[model samples]
Target: MSRTLVIGDIHGGLKALEQVLERAHVTTNDKLIFLGDFVDGWNDTPFVIDFLIDLDKTHNCVFIQGNHEEMLLRWLSEGHDNEEWRLHGGQSTVDVYGKIDADRVSAHINFLIKLNDYHLDDQNRLFVHAGFTNQKGVEYEYFKGMFCWDRTLWEAALSMDATLGRKDLFYPQRLALYEEIFIGHTPVTRIGYSVPVNRANVWNVDTGAAFKGRLTIMDVDTKEFWQSRPLPELYPDEKGRN
Candidate 1:
């Protein structure tokens, strides 16, 4: 049977990405949903983007726009500069793009430009890079950026009272909008988890590959996951957003 797999933030660790795919035994039969931040952190930003673009040629893949992708787009298309972005791993991407030819740069821009803000599957499963804020759900969110930048959704999920039922007056309405939500911006490692985390109905897949954590891919339906080795070990010489 075909499986739908949700992957977390890459942060440019191509080795980790490759290892996870191998470990997961991914095939063309499986649908891969990537939770953005394709660039940044490790030195393989451009390479990761290229790999994903190529992977799409043979597999069903959904690439969500991450805040880092947004920042990289701004830098590539408008010459916009965010020092904060640089400090957090943007410089590595910039350095890689500097030596790349114009055609590939254009292709990377095209790839980043066409990323999805969020994807809601037929199962009512939501896959987003970050989180949405509006209680009414993603459609009612006033700012499109919130789809790729908001943390409130995750925070609210984290803060929930386990005994609260959906019908309770104090239950969060955002959690009621979907069968499940998969997000990737905030790392679960921040909360001391080195693996995927489930809070309320929201699943955080970002195992903090950008920091001192592993990259993960999970079967959305089964919740069975596979992870790469700690990124620091995979890229021994570089400091991955540490």
Candidate 2:
């Protein structure tokens, strides 16, 4: 099979995303695994969604639902007006698609609702928007908190050497389950982080493109990566949260 490339948070930084793909020289045979956050915090949410949908139609693309995407689906299901939605970039989404007819909106919401929580490729790579489950009485399969806000699993996965003061954080150590995990949802200062805990695997590829940081992509098998520097701020010009 061809190699798979995993991409991290877009956050509406379509320009950066496109540039990263160009730099990576992504080909038709290569698979793209997107770690969600497809929209929000930037001006091109509609364009990004449309581009992603088209890409999926033409290529082999696997996308996991990020917390921001989950929020969008929730808002659509329960009426799109709430304090939380307004605070978390939903207003911009509404502004983009609110003028569209009801049928299109319903279709978009339905498309998002069907997204899977995680996707495991044949090559033994786990692709998810965030890290694995929570430790406090939450099953890994049911750990919604980890996907959106939990940092424990993310840190543990990246803590390569115990001497670095990270082992204590992941006490009762859980052996890694996959050969590699390609994840997003936490934008690191760098384009990617790797922990050789079990093998030469485990990677976090979120570079916070929407926050005037880099956008990144990594090949799952070869570990080849590419990044695009952020452009100057445009529109609304406010800081965003993870």
Candidate 3:
């Protein structure tokens, strides 16, 4: 049977992305849902976009918009670069395309502009770059920015001690809107895990590919995961986002 593979924040670690895909044995039949942050950090931002474009041709790929992508889009469209974005890995993305190709950059901009805020699969699995503030089902159209920037949802999940006996009392009702919620943005490495972290029905899969951890991909149905070598190991000569 075909499976659904949910990937974490890529952050331009092309090699890590490639390795995780290979390890996961992803095929055209499998649905691939990327949690975003596809660019920035590592030096292969352009290459990462090119690869994903190619991958989408063969597979069922759902790309979610990330805060980094949002920042990049704002910079491109508004012609005013955000210093904060540049400081947090966007500079590397700009550096990758030193002398920007207007046509290519335009294409990339279009791609980024068209990214969805979130995706809900047939199984009621909600995939987003970050968490939502909605207490009911995700209102991505209304809270596009929050879909890729909010941490309150994850923070709420983290605060709940699943080890406690009463799950319904501790787990927020918002999370129950979906059978499972998969997110990126907040890397699992912050919690000291190099693997996907699960809390109630929310799963954080970003293993900090932009920093010290590796990129991760998980089979949504099976919960089986695949990870790349650490970012430092993948790109020895560069500091991704340390």
**Candidate No. with top lDDT:** 1
Worst 10 contiguous positions by lDDT, candidate 3:
162-171
Badly placed stretches (over 4 Å) of model 3 are 140-142, 163-170
- What lDDT would candidate 3 get against the real structure? 0.88
lDDT of each: 0.93, 0.68, 0.88
Location of the lowest summed lDDT over 10 successive residues in candidate 1: 162-171
lDDT, candidate 3, 23-42, per-residue tens: 99888889999999999999
**Model 3 clashing residue pairs (backbone):** none
lDDT of 1 by residue, 1-242 (tens): 89999999999999999999999999999999999898999999989989999999999999999999999999999999999999999988888888889899899999999999999999888999899888898888889999888999999999999888777887898888898999999999999999999988999999999999999999998999999999999999999895
TM-score of 1: 0.98
> What TM-score would candidate 2 get against the native?
0.80
lDDT of 1: 0.93
Looking at model 3, residue 67 earns an lDDT score of: 94
The TM-score values for the models, in the order shown, are: 0.98, 0.80, 0.95
Q: Give the backbone clash total of model 2.
A: 0
RMSD of each: 0.8, 4.5, 1.7
